[model samples]
Target: MSTTADQIAPAHDEHHAPRGLLRWLTTTNHKEIGTLYLVFSLTMFFVGGTMALIIRAELFQPGLQIVEPYFFNQMTTMHALVMIFGAVMPAFVGLANWLIPMMIGAPDMALPRMNNWSFWIMPFAFTLLLSTLFMDGGGPAGGWTLYPPLSLQTGAAFPFVILAIHMMGVSSVMGAINVIATILNLRAPGMTLMRMPLFVWTWLITAYLLIAVMPVLAGAVTMLLTDKYFGTSFFNAAGGGDPVMFQHIFWFFGHPEVYIMILPAFGIVSQIIPTFARKPLFGYASMVYATASIAFLSFIVWGHHMFTVGMPLAGELFFMYATMLIAVPTGVKVFNWMATMWRGSMTFETPMLFAVAFVVLFTIGGFSGLMLAIAPADFQYQDTYFVVAHFHYVLVPGAVFSIMAATYYWLPKWTGHMYDEKLGRLHFWCSAIGVNVLFFPQHFLGLAGMPRRIPDYALQFAGFNMISSIGAFLFGLSQLIFLWVVIKCIRGGEPAPAKPWEGAHGLEWTLPSPAPLHTFQTPPQIDPSEAHG
Candidate 1:
């Protein structure tokens, strides 16, 4: 049967006739890489969340219930590694892969083959990590921070840990480079920086951060490795290399790492809030300035994480003030969102529910972060369950929630089918309530002096631990609702329209459900994607 322009694609898939696993394995298409990144990320999410469950289960009764302290530490370390690199970062990169080209009016990523390589390497990197469990000594237990001294003594897996970190960093750098090239060099003529989507703008900034810092991470971990094996002391205290010097280097990369995680969420909220509220984004200029300011501030304030590390009062004061400055730009973003929704029609689709929640909850995370930034108070709060609670709130609600919201908001566009609205709401409510229950009590535990990263906690921490564990299980199980909704939509659902959401904007929305393989092959308008049918 010869195919013709009038012929419908098999199974009505967006990527027609990508037969067998080869389609996935050898693929260079932006959408396919995006799908790979997303599916890989979702898989890691469960895996990481399961590690969290085990941690909570151990803490359920105050005594270790599941594993030895060493193994438990490994669990926490790998949980963070998998979540940050294997899960959240990949999720946003996946978003960039799928949406960036369309949003910016580029035909595809600047380097398509490199995109596939970048995504494919992640699975292998994590494989090396998980394999460490069976190694002679076990995995890195220095936490995902991978701080030295403790990192020095790990067995067979320690080197693998360094290598895996390097691999992940390499993959990220490649992805970022491609993004930078695409956004800067490939946008349609007259698509000035201001008119580009905030998502694009944020990603452009984020990709630059990745390029700059992944190398720092690379250098730090490389130094750690050589110090362990080759007898170098880039971070070795004995060789007049201060261990705290390594902290400065690691966190210099680490703090911007935080902004890297949340910046895309900012872009996403910018897109979602406007559609549901039927309003233009308020303070767009301020939003961009605020985001850039935060990124700039992020570079200088890496020292706040080291408040307890015994820096001089001068250093402490400088870092504290630098960290506090971040609150201003963050506040600008928060206020902009509120003003966007201040006087407009708003709908509570699954996406909007999550976006609105992200604003409230991420702000809470930011406040907690600001408090932590205060050096003196941190002497009390450092290493407590309070810090644990704060980040999980930021991460789970902030990053993961944004990913889920994006899935729901764009599922129709991707699959040409509407997700079950009822199931979507159920997923939202269950996950939301369950998440709060899981994390909130830890705040009290932290305030009460429960130190973090210990395999077990003191007996007095028992009551709250039990409640948190129950919430953990519930929250873990609630995600299945999301999985089900996505699966059901992909397999079969009611047809979707070109512009499924009434107030949707941008080029992606202009395409029919199940976006085509090649779109806007020739730029049409001054800002090509803004070109209407």
Candidate 2:
């Protein structure tokens, strides 16, 4: 087995890759496809972020200042859709595509053609969804959840949104399949299941979750399509269908989908904490078990999201306890991260800053989640700004922060140049402060009896809304600094060694900075002592 850095392909294979735009279109290379995924995700991030700024801008003042209420609804609906499916999910998948093969010491993803197809589907799917905004009835104003009846009321946008969702689902399922296949079959000699990096481990579990639930969402949306156009009544109360049943099916997919987004973040933090702490991860096997436990609990706790929908007392109690039970494993993970850092020679690079912030802030999100888990408490919090605050805390600082951490941690390796550290820290601070200010006041607004998804609020909610809007602008603007950091690093910077971070571990670190287009054509031998559990 070879332990060498990725090497350029032999001269005979050089011409096989097409030049320029054709290279991107026809390439089956994992690294190139991964770059494509990252670039697309960045584009969508701004697209969705623009929608969010519009929402914040409208709510910056008291009443109907910027856009009409219907347009506001479209912004809310499309913002959630674009962020969840287009921005966050694709970012994780992009990371998977770039790092998974390298981590496992495989040359490329298993089923390369499927990988290419999976990525190409996204731009078209999103285009179809976004095109609806220009149509007669405007884009989906029914919210990202696409709850029935209201969703059924959507005009020309109905079929387009549904079809776009189906296409996104199909793309995700295929990407998940490719991930599972690559991880399961393409590991190098001695890279056993447990020996694989935590990033790889979390993605493996996430892929399984995707396989299980994406189809459920696909089915639910298909039912919606049928109910709307074909006179079926899967969720139409007029035809004897139960709208509550739609909530059940949707949440069944929705709760696990939440974990699907965050679980990869968990893997990333698990990797970074140990690296910066200059220690092998603490309780490595326990972390793996804890991740699996959280995944298992995710399926059972979907009912909590629907506690206010008039579930029977017994059902409500069942969901409440099940939801609370997740805190146990999550607590384990948090404890392990702290323990990993306990008394170690810890450093606070940009990546470490984000990872540490993920722990504290995401814990805040989790505690609020616990608050929501209590069935009786949920009755107050549901459909309120508190719920908005809770999830944004989880997502923006939790998952999105982890993605940023990963970019900083690996950018040196990816670009073979060290980024400007000072700028990176500035981006992190602005993001951290801005996110809290943006979200913390929303918690107060929810407690003050403010509802979510409304464009305008009563005069009483004005001050906190103003503060939240300011934070939104600050947070949104901070990302430009991040964009600048990435671009600058790509063009020119201090040249990096193969292993830029002294504490970093894994097969990826073993490869050179700016790893070659093709890597590990001969499998690398794994050293048990160096395995990142």
Candidate 3:
């Protein structure tokens, strides 16, 4: 009689999967593409981090000792572009690729060929973007927002930057389409929408958000391209176009873009907390609804970013209240996370430590966000280090930390080897301390009337800037430990079991550790009792 493994194994042999460098270049396998995206993301993370350190080095003292003012601006601009587009977003996409099909018991993404194409496009897009830094104008320095006139001043780099952005947008949109198609069409039998994991649900919502907003950014940049070269004047003051209109259009896409980066983070944290707490996620339905609510609120609150632009009092009030309204759904998610951990057999593993930090630190960011949402208060904080601090808290601890947690949570399954927990904890503590020391003082700097995006600062801002720079170095250096841990695990470690975490519940854990090149070739049966809820 045939064994159970023989009965359930993929119809084809594993050797049928492509091999060698050509496999990575041309293969349609979700797992390989996911690895490519992840490795690319990690590479870019260091690239972006280097730019950040350059910035800190310059600001280490009140004077501009290290780099020229324009180069400083370039560092700030390029750093945001690299981190947002190159690092964090792709890292999340990589996670989705690796886990979504496994979670829902699909054999592969619905559009595997398109998935391959999506990953391939990113390298070229970023290459074109980074190439601009060497051009005469020294990259687009008007900020990643690329506000026009100032952005219009960008020289030979202009068209290249726009093209690079378009390429990134195309890649993102195609990836989003793949995600939606996969989730909607490829779920295993009995895997109902409500039964899917939060990570899948969040990506579904995020995919829609991507489809909706990526084009707006594409359009805005296209207009910028036209105004610069084709003379269309969409944001030109002399041509009777309003520069502020660019801000309006940008923020309309920009704010939802923020949620696009974050909703999945909420999803990641949602998955981790319950696993470590040894509890079914508290208020699962509420968490789903809250994520949806946050996405909805994101579109209406774009005006808050433009409050200092002198809108009418009514407009300001409306944006302020709408922005504040987001807190309701956000609060629900936070409360549910805490409740899930309440009185449970909690394990403080690396993933849980990061998850817990995400809750606390992200809440701090949220509170600071509320302060910025106050129309009058934003006037004080707008474009200062306070704004910088607020967002870093959100993106770093909030989004980046969640990504790190997911890595630790799933690395065992991916590598079939457990990461060194001792070293993992060390990375966590160093990162946690370093990130705070880097960002926290900036809030005080902004409150004390220090402006942002400048090479030099007033004498009063010196002490905090120095402290912040030290923190930046600390945080940047700590990432080496993270890199070491990942490499070490991949090379050799104690073998991991299929279910490394006792409390973990998902279809992913049903597969053998270091999940096969092909999985769910025959759809795995879903059990309602084993659902993540």
Cα displacement (Å) at residue 151, model 1? 0.6
lDDT by residue (1-533, candidate 3, tens digit) is 11222233455455775678887997677887888999999999999999999999999998869999998898899999999999999999999999998999998777777788899999999999999999997998989999988999998999999999899899899889989988998899999999999999999999999999999999999999999888787898899999999999999999999998999999999999999999999998998899999999998999999999979999999999999999999999999999999998998999999999999999999999999999998888999999999999999999999999999999999999999999999999999999999999999999998998999999999999999999999999999999999999999899999999999999999999999888988889899988863
- Compute the lDDT of residue 170 as modeled in candidate 2: 91
- Write down the worst ten-residue block by lDDT for model 1: 1-10
| Model 2 agreement with the true structure over 476-521: per-residue lDDT tens digits | 9999999999999999999999988889889998888898888888
RMSD of candidate 3 to the truth, in angstroms, is: 3.5
The stretch of ten residues in a row with the least summed lDDT in candidate 2 is 1-10
lDDT of 2 at 472: 100
lDDT (C-alpha, whole model) for all candidates: 0.87, 0.92, 0.92
Q: Give the per-residue Cα lDDT of candidate 1 at 119.
A: 90
Q: Superposing all C-alpha atoms, what RMSD in Å does each candidate have to the true structure? A: 4.3, 2.9, 3.5
Instruction: Give per-residue CA lDDT, model 1, range 59-138, as digits (tens).
Output: 88977678999989999999999999999999999999999887767777778778888998999999998899889888
Model 2 / residue 65 / CA error / Å:
0.3
Task: Give me candidate 3's TM-score against the actual structure.
Answer: 0.97
Clashing pairs in 2: none
Off by over 4 Å in 3: 1-13
Q: How far off is residue 82 in model 2, in Å?
A: 0.4
